[model samples]
Target: MLGLIGIVMSSEDPNNTDQKTRLEMLNDSVIKLDSFIEDILNYSRNTRMGVVMEEINFEEILEEIRNGHKFMEGANKLKPLVEIIQKEKFISDKKRIIVILNNIISNAIKYRDTSKEESFVSVFVECDSKKAVITIEDNGIGIADDKQEKVFDMFYRATKLSNGSGLGMYIVKETLEKLDGIITLESSLNKGTKFSIQIPNQTN
Candidate 1:
């Protein structure tokens, strides 16, 4: 799909207004399809395998996630603060963790509050010998009070802004359960959303 996007973009003519609009639409469609396929693959991989216990490098993981999203459209408009206050040997399923973080970060960019003067997404990780505490917060178009509980259900979508495969959070919840982790959500409509996560270090 990305290859297709590149081909479509390269063929665009600067003088053709309708062609530019159509090209943008085509590009967006392919991107969404690519995302949906990736989401499905992630879900399948998590369910098929056992959690691999390994030491997770918080700083490296955060940097990788940041770089992955930098090419996204609204990502540049948002002020992002990602910090690791304390990091020790935090062991968990690295693949599952990346899937979880990627889905959450992707949503932050997708559902940004266009009405606001500025948008922001913050991620902080604190870890000890036993567990890791991760907080992902974003000032975006937040989940509604009524839809919060269903966000982790299969094929459920909380916001209309969702162009996702609807399996992202469901996969997150499933993966957390496999790792004996806990996740809590707090949000106000049109205000913002925050996810607080506590995952035990399997090395113990």
Candidate 2:
């Protein structure tokens, strides 16, 4: 009886309980911090690596981007709808182009309203003889006017709670600028954000 009583007292000790709970919480936080670091590394690698330009089919790129988001939604048990309007093909780095679309659309889906079942994302592409324009728009929560520019800054999260490294738009900006392209954003809080990139067909 005394042995059993001693074990019970040891288990019920306030210091031991507090220490066990603290360790568990710290372990969970460490796991989360590790994940955060990995994400940062991946984002940095994507931005730092350069690709060679080639004949890239705009439709195919759109499809690839759509398929990627679809897979993500499926994994997260969410339904994603993607719409694309393409007018022409552009000559650019296929991988880089895919990166731009994928990152932006992923963020859109990530920020989508979880309370709503009919959430969807849209992508549009247009082109002329000189420049090709790609636009990605989402129906999720939008960015504030003042935060629009900050969205393209490295590690700048428009909202701290957002599930992104904040490097998506920054990478997009760098990649487009490398291709002599420009990105513009039009957004309003609660309305959604639209990112449009215009790249020259020929770098002369």
Candidate 3:
């Protein structure tokens, strides 16, 4: 009876361990998913919420984003490779523009190749007669050629190791489409990724 009891306890120990591991993983996944959902809410609120559109300063919006986000700060903590090549002021809704810039910049910071010696990211802004273009590029682990299209899909991750809810790009795509804009991606694995966004200057 004593031996049987000991064996039962031993058997249960492994089960408990497995259960604990699964629970922790689930919790982490939930947290990541929650953050992703919050980002979507922010994007939605920027457009759908009861805020009237007004003439906004893009430089101020970018500055406010730079000042508030801790993630970008950390990205530049080690030798500071992230760079804003150009900044521009545009006449648009402040909240909406902020949401668009924040999402793109946040991902650039988050996906940076921390292992590299010169981890860097860049943002460029240009406005012309017809439209405005914003480009965000990063020297991070880029997407594979085949999986590039999948990045825009909801809840799609290229690898099992990705610790994310996989909704960032999806939200980005949806937001741009809603705003009558288009986003283009150029990427190569181990090289990097560049996202070029073009939006019309006229108000909707």
**Clash totals, every prediction:** 0, 0, 0
Q: Which tens-of-lDDT digit does each residue in 1-204 have in candidate 3?
A: 323434554555565877557555655565576676777687567457654456555566677877756433345642323333234334444566677777767766666677787776677777654567888788877888999888889888875556666776777777676556889999988878899998766544
Provide TM-scores for the models.
0.94, 0.70, 0.71
* Per-model lDDT: 0.87, 0.68, 0.67
The parts of candidate 2 lying over 4 Å away from their true place are: 1-51, 73-89
Q: Which candidate is the best by TM-score?
A: 1
Model 1, residue 58: what's the lDDT? 81
Candidate 1 regions off by >4 Å? 7-11
By TM-score: ranked, best first: 1, 3, 2
lDDT of prediction 1 = 0.87
TM-score of 3: 0.71
Better of 1 and 3 by lDDT: 1
Q: Write the per-residue lDDT of candidate 1 for residues 97-125, one digit (tens) a residue.
A: 88888889888999999999999999999
